[model samples]
Target: MHRITALAAATITLAFGLGTGAATATATATDDAARVAPAAFSCSPGNFCMYSDWNGGGTRCQWPDERKANTADNCSFIQRGENVRSVWNATGHRVQYYTGTNYNSRVGSTPSGQGGNLQGSYQIRSFKPQ
Candidate 1:
């Protein structure tokens, strides 16, 4: 009777341990999926748009048919010192952007009607038609 009771206790302990481990693994997988999920793009047509987060998530600053020598002048996200992680050029011309105001320290450009994720390491302080 003692041996049977001990065996049942050990089996219950092992089963509980496996269940806890499986639960932890499932939670980790869920967290990973949330981190890699792509955000939605929401820029309008005929405008240049900048995003504060990757894949067009977070705050957006957009200008329509205009050049901005100082994006922080009117863009709330830029004024808050948030880096532009993505962009969309919904304009008629190729748009060049820079890391410094007045077109200094050119970072890159997005051709007309094209855009995607950026390095997310620098701010877009200015932009103009290329």
Candidate 2:
């Protein structure tokens, strides 16, 4: 009876240890995926571009129309639960970005011929000429 109990306890302990190890491994993988950097984006002249991931990677939305009232329903990035992490304004004029649809709640602006990464506060739901 003593041996049986000891064997049962050992089995339980080993199973618990393995489960914890697997959980840790899965968490590590998720962290690594989030930290992965996206590839560089190429923007053409006279257009504005937004990236779904940092450094101009992931899904891209470009516009030559100069104004977008709604991006949530049309943009692939928003569909994927991702926000604009970087931007490139190749247009001649500076671009104004807003947090809400239809250009409400102005957040920031990006200069023409320049681009940079965002800190995740401004998701860029709408944008237009400055």
Candidate 3:
């Protein structure tokens, strides 16, 4: 009977300790919320437009509005001086493309993205292809 009582007490203590640890962890994450700043941007919409403007000093070109390229150029020109280019698929999935806006302007590589961090890796999920 004495052993059973001690075991029960220890179990309660252990559970309480674990609960306190979780509370501490959550508190720490909450405290650092503000310090966790947004990653610095080296690319922008204009970077994409540079290709639109001329494909790297070539000539302002227009992207086709097809399933393979919905609003892909769907929206207006990448924006002036903006380098990070995010476009939406037909269903409106926002994808940040790479710096060079070639036909396969796949994200994850660019002059500005020479040394990208985890945040630099962009997604390329299928959209309406627009």
Candidate 4:
């Protein structure tokens, strides 16, 4: 009788442990899905916009059909040293961005009317038409 009771208790504990692990994994997956959901696009036409969060979820800075040798000059978020995790090029031409001021250290570019999430690992300090 004692051996049977011990086995039953162990089995219940193992079942509960497995159930809890599955629940935790489900919650983690839900959280990841929420984080990756697409954010609203708010950039205006004929403008170039940069966001500090993935999928354009955080602070934004925009420029109208113009080259910016130093984005932090007038952009509050850039000035605060936030990374540019997304960009929307609503202008009429492809826009190339850089990791340093004065268009140094070229990173990438986006075509007109196209934009999406970036690697979120670097800041865009300058940008101009490609």
Model number with the top TM-score: 4
Per-model lDDT: 0.79, 0.74, 0.32, 0.79
Show where candidate 3 strays beyond 4 Å.
Answer: 1-64, 67-79, 91-98, 108-130
Tell me each candidate's TM-score. 0.68, 0.65, 0.21, 0.68
Q: Write the per-residue lDDT of candidate 1 for residues 17-86, one digit (tens) a residue.
A: 7889846544543442122212265666668889999888899888885698999998999898889999
Candidate 1 residue pairs in backbone clash: none
lDDT of 4: 0.79
lDDT of 2 at 95: 91
- On lDDT, who's better, 1 or 2? 1
Clashing pairs in 2: none
Backbone clashes in model 1: 0
Count of backbone collisions in candidate 4: 0
**How many steric overlaps does candidate 3 have?**
14
Quote model 3's TM-score.
Answer: 0.21
Question: Candidate 3's error at 53, in angstroms?
Answer: 20
- RMSD of candidate 2 to the truth, in angstroms, is 13.8
Give lDDT tens digits, candidate 3, residues 42-124. 12221222122211322222222222232234333333332322321112122234334443555442222121232313332
Stretches of candidate 1 above 4 Å error?
1-39
